[model samples]
Target: MIVLPYLQTPRARIRLAEASDAPMLLRYREENHAHLSPWEPLREPEYYTLAHCLKTITEGREYALQDRGYPLMAFDPDEQTILATFTFANVVRGVFQGCHLGYGVAERMQGHGLMREILEPGIAWAFGELGLHRVMANYLPRNERSAKLLAKLGFEREGYARRYLRIAGVWEDHVLTARICPDG
Candidate 1:
């Protein structure tokens, strides 16, 4: 299990998801349904309910404990309001030392540099605590913000993959990017 430490940015707090966070998470998803739906997979009708949220949280914890993945939530430091979520999945340890990242910030919080603040520490922790050598992030070519954010974090644009992901019910092309930890 990868025990996560609380990470703080200028305006956000990034930490692991717990069972108690289900309601907040569900609320965020509900509010951002239209905003996120375009970039995410289709969710079950029940997936946004409290019960589903709890199940997700519990599964996230289990994955983290087993070092299978890391699911993190970002919140406003002052208000303690849920602001976004991110996950480090496809974790391959041992000699491989890599993981794939997935993240999204609320629409209202889009231009606040919150993503960078959240990603920097999270990336650092993956490299430091997880001893990962490289991290991969992918985004639709049209997602300029995500592209810029990844570039700002030292990720190099490696190439493009067609039909790399199923987004909004369609297979979409993505720009593959990677960041190597200098300390690794």
Candidate 2:
């Protein structure tokens, strides 16, 4: 597993969410509940509670220890506000050095290139520090924003996964994409 670092970007910092950040994490979920519903799984209102946030952060730490994954949060540099989360999940080491990517940006943080800022170093750390050779991401076909970001990050659109993901409780189609570290 990789030791999480505070990644500096032009507009934000990306780092691991701490137990102390439970309140802010809960706030992120609450504020983006409606705005993220379409793209995210249906969450109960209380799913964003402090207790849940604390448990999730603790779980993330455990997962990192098992080399299962790393969960990262993006924050506004000036105010130190959590703005988004970027996750590298399903990590497979040994010969199959790879992982899957998942993310969500706070509604207010959208359109300011925060996604790219967080992803650039995140992906680098995946390859450089975690010894990953490939990273994959998938998105609903109608999610133009996600598709664009994957492409912008040099991920190739591999194919469509027919009814592959159960999102919002429905099996939905997704465009599969991947990026291989050239230097790996």
| Residue-level lDDT for 84 in candidate 2 | 87
Cα lDDT over the full model 1: 0.88
TM-score of each: 0.96, 0.95
Compared to the true structure, candidate 1 yields what TM-score?
A: 0.96
lDDT per residue for candidate 1 within 1-184, as digits (tens), equals 4567588988888888777788888899899999999889888899889999999899988888888899899988863578989999989978888999999999899898888888989999999888899999999999998889999999999999999989888999999999998985
lDDT of 2 by residue, 1-184 (tens): 3576678888787888889889888888888988788887777756878999999999998888888989988887863578889899999978889999999999997888889888999999898888899999999999999989999999998999999977898889999999999896
Candidate 1 off by > 4 Å? none
Runs off by more than 4 Å, candidate 2? none
Candidate with top lDDT is 1
After the best TM-score superposition of candidate 2, give how far the Cα of residue 165 lies from its true spot, in angstroms.
1.3
Name the lDDT value of residue 146 in candidate 2: 94
| Clashes (N, CA, C under 3 Å) per candidate | 1, 0
Error of 2 at 51 (Å): 0.4
